[model samples]
Target chain A: AQSVAQPEDQVNVAEGNPLTVKCTYSVSGNPYLFWYVQYPNRGLQFLLKYITGDNLVKGSYGFEAEFNKSQTSFHLKKPSALVSDSALYFCAVRDSVSGTYKYIFGTGTRLKVLA
Target chain B: EAEVAQSPRYKITEKSQAVAFWCDPISGHATLYWYRQILGQGPELLVQFQDESVVDDSQLPKDRFSAERLKGVDSTLKIQPAELGDSAMYLCASSLGLERINEQFFGPGTRLTVL
Candidate 1:
């Protein structure tokens, strides 16, 4: 089974401070990892994806992710946080082994960027 | 930016009543998906469509939930006899369905509140 885990239910950080949201995964084969952000009353927006690239991948809104295969982790990070960055973050893994192209998402972590 | 469209941004209904949500995916996207997102949780895949055919629906509660994308352009998800547990956000997404690019584009989502 392919699954992702986001251990934190909420993470608070002050504006201009660096932020990190933890994510780990379990997969039978090579994992396709992705990060998504959801604002209140809105759908999720894709942040970044890690397939088979340089471990560090940059994404929209100055966000990035570091893919660590040995640790089975793909953590989302930002150099500096902004009040508008507050939202729900999710980590997902694509189950290609099942040949269904289905995404298995984590429980989600609410990010509160305080100004 | 071509964005997906969803109707009835908010819906409130009593239990046992029928409710339906609609989605229009981005133009030229071949794959579509429906997801249910509960508060404080990540979105769960309910159904996926490749054109007008159903590709996967293992997680869907077929006893009361149904989805269709007859023309492959727009889709609809219907829940009969809605239950309090059914209160959630219905999210629709679409992808190019190509092997290399699997990132999905999502709609704003429909929020349902079942009393």
Candidate 2:
């Protein structure tokens, strides 16, 4: 079975400051990790993904994530946060060896970019 | 700027009523997914379709919930005699399926309230 964990229920960051949202996962095989953001009353938007090769992956809206194999973690980071960045963030993982496209998602982390 | 489309942005229905949601994937997307998201939680996959065939429906409540991707283009999800617990957001996502690295594009989602 595959699963994801987002330890933080909420993260508050000042606008223009750095922001980080942590995520971890457990899977039977290699993992394909992804990050998504959702605004209130809207659907989720893809931020970035880590399949292979790169430990650091850049995404849209100036967001990026670092994949740590030893820690089984993929933490989302943004150098300069914006007010518009406040939203619900989710971390997801899929087992690369399972031959299944099913994605397991974390409970989610609420990010608040305070001005 | 092709995007997945979902119908009925909001729906409020009485308990025991029947409800349905629709989605249209991007022009060339080969994989479609339906997910249910409760408040303060990540989206959970209800079903997945590869083209017009069902790839996975193990998580779906087959007793009351049914889904289909008829022409490999559009899909529908139906819930009969909806219960109060059924109130949540229904999200539709699609992926190109051309490569394992393709990101899924999501719809705005339909917020359902079974009162």
Candidate 3:
């Protein structure tokens, strides 16, 4: 079974400060990891993904994530926080061995960026 | 940018009532997905369609939930005899195809409130 875990239920950060939302995965083989953000009453928006390339991947809205193979972690990070970035974030993973395209998501982590 | 479209942004119904939601994926996309998102949780895939064929529906409650993508363009998800637990946000997303890393574009989602 492929599953993702977000250790924090919420993460608070001040404007202009760096922020990180932790995520880890459990899978039998290689994993495809992704991050998505959802605002209130809205659908989720794709952030970034790690398939098989560099450890650090850049995404839209000035956000990025670091993929750590040894840690089995893909933590989303931003150089500087913005009030508009406050939203619910999710971490997802897909197992390569199963040949399944289904993305198993974490519970979610509410990000509150303070101005 | 092209976006997935969904109908009935909000729906309120009583237990055992019938409800339906529609979705139109971005042009040229071949895969469509329906997800259920409960409050404080990430979206869970209810069904996935490759064109007009059902690719996955392992988590879908087959007894009450049914989905169709007749023409391979637009899709609809229907639920009969809805339960209180069915009160959730129904999200529709689309991807180009089944790849190692396919980005899924999301719709605004339909919020269902079962009374």
Pick the DockQ winner: 3
The per-residue C-alpha lDDT of model 1 at residue A54 equals 98
Docking class of 3: high
Model 3: lDDT to the true structure: 0.93
User: Model 2 — TM-score against the truth?
Assistant: 0.97
iRMSD for each candidate structure, in the order shown: 1.2, 1.4, 0.9
DockQ of 2: 0.74
Off by over 4 Å in 1: none
Candidate 2 lDDT, B2-115, residue by residue in tens: 888999999999999999999999998998999999988999999989899887888999999999988899999999989999999999999987346677899999999999
RMSD of each: 1.0, 1.2, 1.0
DockQ of each model vs. true complex: 0.77, 0.74, 0.82
Runs in model 2 with CA error above 4 Å? none
Model 3 stretches astray by more than 4 angstroms = none
Q: Put down candidate 1 lDDT per residue, A10-88, tens digits, no spaces.
A: 9999999999999999999888999999988888899999989699999999999999999999999999999999999
Q: Rank the candidates by DockQ, best first.
A: 3, 1, 2
lDDT of each: 0.93, 0.92, 0.93
Error of 2 at A37 (Å): 0.5
